[model samples]
Target chain A: MGIAREHDLHKRRFSRNRGVGLALAAFVAIIFGLTVVKVSNMDVVGSYAAGSLTAGGDK
Target chain B: MSDTSARTTPPPAIGGEGDFADYFALLKPRVMSLVVFTALVGLLVAPVPAHPMIALAAILFIAIGGGAAGALNMWWDADIDAMMQRTKARPIPAGRVAPGEALAIGVALSGMSVVMLGLAANWVAAGLLAFTIFFYAVVYTMWLKRRTPQNIVIGGAAGAFPPMIGWAVATGGVSPESLLMFLIVFVWTPPHFWALALFVRSDYEHAGVPMLTVTHGRRATRAHILAYTLLLAPVTIGAGLTSVGGPVYLMVAVALNLWLIWGALNIRRRSEETATADGYRAEKAFFRFSIFYLFLHFGALLAEAALRPYGLGGW
Candidate 1:
């Protein structure tokens, strides 16, 4: 019984961790995309601040 | 159960029935959330700008680093945590996660966060994050916590570094504005934590951690709270005078400091007998308010940042 329980626990833990590395991979891809955006001179901060302020219109 | 069957089978998992949530708890999500928010504010309010995705990546790495510190802290303090009622049910102490697993996760994530932050941002930010993890895991948890009442006082620097790291990620260096944010949190920590110690005195006593209330009496601890809060008011106000601040931050700081100082004074005036009679209500209220004190201060910085394009922010 103890052995069976141990097997089940390990099974569950493994199942839970399944694709965790993939999730991390996605995060890495997103970070890579960010690096590309930064290197390419995508001025998201300045543009967004300008757009938002324009939209707000003196508020 | 034959000996052959037992020998053929594997042993029970050292921490039985542990689940995904238990591992998440090991990350100390609450602490991570606070670290993420402060780092984001630091990045946003910097004079230098970053791409949104880059900023997001930096915050993510910083949060992971904070969680790594928390996991390592839990691993080291498992024994003490088990003794304290407040932490007796943490993943390690509750037997939901093995200490070895926590340590593995901590060390692995520490390297991952620091290296990733370097890739996502700058080496300076990455170095700060690495030092933050080391300070929390080693200096605070392994060394100071069990030895002295000043553990949180010095260890608070670990928490205060996130904003500076964020600023470094944006500007590639620390500045007066970033230092001001760091100073506000650093000074705020003792008063904030000491208030908690006042109410949760027995937990630290039972855990044998030498909190101020443990080393000195409640009266001295209360005195310390008042003294620190008084000292904190200036740093809190000084932050408003920096590039991060404007009318919004200044107004918020002044109002909050008045209330915080009042709370500390109230606690100072109340005797231990009085606090006991009322269930330490004043200290509890102060503790609750202190959380808002930090959030609003940072929120005001965000507000100031937002208002900057309109020429309504900064000195």
Candidate 2:
């Protein structure tokens, strides 16, 4: 019977587990987005490299 | 057999059944909102700009860091929270979340937020965020909160750091303007909190939190609010002279400070007996206005930044 899938404990904890799962997923997405931005040199390092020549440019 | 056992026996513990909302409550979302709004204004008003993704992530990390510090504070102040009517319904006090669990979450989130902020922004912002967490959790929560009447005065620095950190996120370091923003919030804190202390004096009394009202009497607390409000006026208006401040900010600052000082005067003039008769109407109104005062001040800063490109924002 696979230990009864409709356990009360699972029912009670479903929301918590879902919340944590969503949070972790969001964390991963943020990291991925940050990684993409950093690698594309769209962040601080990129601006520093571009210097005054690129200042007041696409911001 | 399992069904039979489940039907026959009750759950062993009801207190640990907290769901996601309870966990979120530990983060103090209301406080986080203030942190977010102030930090956003600080970031926007800076001369430099941040990438959209970086800016959004930096704010997110700062908010998370602020929330983590709140959780840590809740964990440490669980006992006091349990006694105070205003805080007794919090997650830890209500027994929805375990104290240890709250502490763990706080520590973990604090670490994650700092590291992530460093990656998304700059180390200067990250370092400032770390110091802010330490200031709130260790300095304010552990050392000062229960110790002195001036707790909120000094502890206010923790709340004041977010704007500075946001400015650093864009500029990669602190500047005069950022420090001006910090000073504005720093001075604004005592009056704002003291107003709440006036109405909810009993909460601090019962919690043994050593609030000004509990130690120095309501009359003294009222005077303190007015004193701080008087001191805050110049700092608030002085920001108008800075690069970040503009005509719009100055107008907003002048109007708000006038109203704030007027409100504080009303609070100071009232006797406890009169306040009780009026249900602390002036104090409560002052408290509510203080919130709007801060929001509009920051909003004016944002308006200046937004209008700067149009040649109408700054002095």
Candidate 3:
């Protein structure tokens, strides 16, 4: 009985740890996905022109 | 389960082998990317044409300065970072780098970047770069972060300085256009950050950081997000009317503002239980969208600059 109880506690602890790890991984994956989407959609060339004009107008 | 027993922990060291990649990571690449892009815009839009070589050097140094600030932030925040799930794996917290080593790297890079910028560009740009590093590392990281719920509100200023530094690089002075860009970023930081703060309140609480959610409660944070979003719309649109902005930027600004306002309004109306019922998914989506909104607005500014030669644009 003692051995079985110890084994069950270990199983529960292991499962709890796995759950936390999985949640953390999912969070990181979401942040990475968001970053990739933002970078891909960035209008880099257009921004350059707008920036230049702003500088030009100040003169 | 078997893998856990088989795993062997690596020895503790601040940065092993002194590899270029490790050094680069210390700079906070995401933040540096924004600094580079804004500075590039500042250079391109400036009436004064910098020789390509000088412009490249200026941008490179500005990026290095940005990295130095990140390294110092990591060093100081290492203790809290270890507690937060999101930051627990960072270099210092993970035991891959030492706090003191990170501090040294930050200080050395900070000086190098500033001095090189002064030589390759102008003293004004160098001065701005120096101030940015100081503001982020000293003022924001050291003084404000742990002490105030308004940390991000004030600390946000450090992040807002890049475009101004870039502008100074080209023109050796500040201008209304750069200030407008600065204002847009400044106002946007609160709502952008507070959205994440709401969802991650537990982490801040665990780390003992006084984020708005921790001090003011979730309802107050939601209210603040709405108020800031409302304030952000005009600043964003006004940038489109500046010499740097044009019809293309204006159209984008209007649409993005409306979408952001919708998200903020939705967030304000939802209860914590309701938000949890949706897996906090709506808040997550808003957080994701906020990142894109800033990138798009700045990207639109670049677009306006491109169309200027045809006499097709004015802000």
Q: Per-candidate TM vs. native?
A: 0.88, 0.91, 0.79
The CAPRI class of candidate 1 is acceptable
TM-score of 2: 0.91
Better of 1 and 3 by lDDT: 1
Per-residue lDDT of model 2, residues B11-114, tens digit only: 54335568888898889999999999999999999999898899999999999999999999999999899898999899887877888899999999999999
Q: In candidate 2, what are the lDDT values of residues A1-59, reduced to their tens digit?
A: 96876775566589789999999999899889888988888566767876855765756
Deviation in Å, model 3, residue B111 alpha carbon: 0.2
**Could you arrange the candidates by lDDT from highest to lowest?**
2, 1, 3
Compose the digit string of candidate 1's lDDT tens values, residues B34-114: 999999999999999987888888898899999999999999999889898889899898888889999999999999999
Per-model lDDT? 0.91, 0.93, 0.84
lDDT for B224 (candidate 1)? 96
- DockQ values of all predictions: 0.31, 0.51, 0.02
Model 1 lDDT tens row, A1-59: 67656576686678557646666788869867876887566577778878999989967
lDDT of model 3 at residue B2? 62
Candidate 2: C-alpha RMSD to true structure equals 5.5
C-alpha DockQ for predicted model 2: 0.51
